[model samples]
Target: MLWNKKEKNKPKNISLKLYSFNEEIIFNGLLTNFPIKEELILEKTIEHFEDYDPCFFHRSVVSRWMYFEIEEYLNKIDEENKSEIKWQELPENIKKILLSDKVINRVIVEKI
Candidate 1:
């Protein structure tokens, strides 16, 4: 696939907000409790990211454009492994999010 000159020059602005209340508290209190401000915020952001898994917005859009065959792709991965596969065997976060009605309808059913 090749992009035309206009497509190549398109601007992009993507934001991923994955922070918890506890992380916000820790970040806000850094100036009063810790000497290191920027360093502490960086460390806290890393820690917060560990808790929340991030799926890129661009990837989601691209996947939808392909007819939302994500399940087929996942099944292929499981089949290639040649092991028993179940929803419980998948990542906890994936299992939880995939089972949700909103995600299912919007990203899966609607696209397919």
Candidate 2:
């Protein structure tokens, strides 16, 4: 059987495990690619979490507050210009909340 263009372009799924601050499994699913490095894994996990549900961080008080703060900040920005906001341009406190250990612990990526 020959592979078609759609098959060739299809994204591969990699096993991923996202842990909470206490090492609890927050997310377990397949990702497009496995991120090898520890930091990369964490970033990927956070990205997945955001894609799955941006409000998942609301479970914690500090995280909840930070999440709303980010929402408020984004709301104030012009709708047409909101898309131009980059992660680095966000406030340090908001960034810290997103990257905080209290919100997420670690991520493990397994190639399938």
Q: After superposition, how far is residue 68 of candidate 1 from its true place, in Å?
A: 7.7
Ten consecutive residues with minimal summed lDDT in candidate 2? 32-41
- TM-score of model 2 vs. true structure: 0.32
Tens digits of per-residue lDDT for model 2, 1-60: 111235444433435465665677655665422122345334434655543322434223
Models, CA RMSD each: 16.2, 15.5
**Candidate 1: clashing pairs of residues:** none
Residues 16-57, candidate 1: write the lDDT tens digits. 122232332212221112122333334334454542333455
Predicted model with the maximum lDDT: 2
Worst 10 residues of 1 by lDDT: 103-112
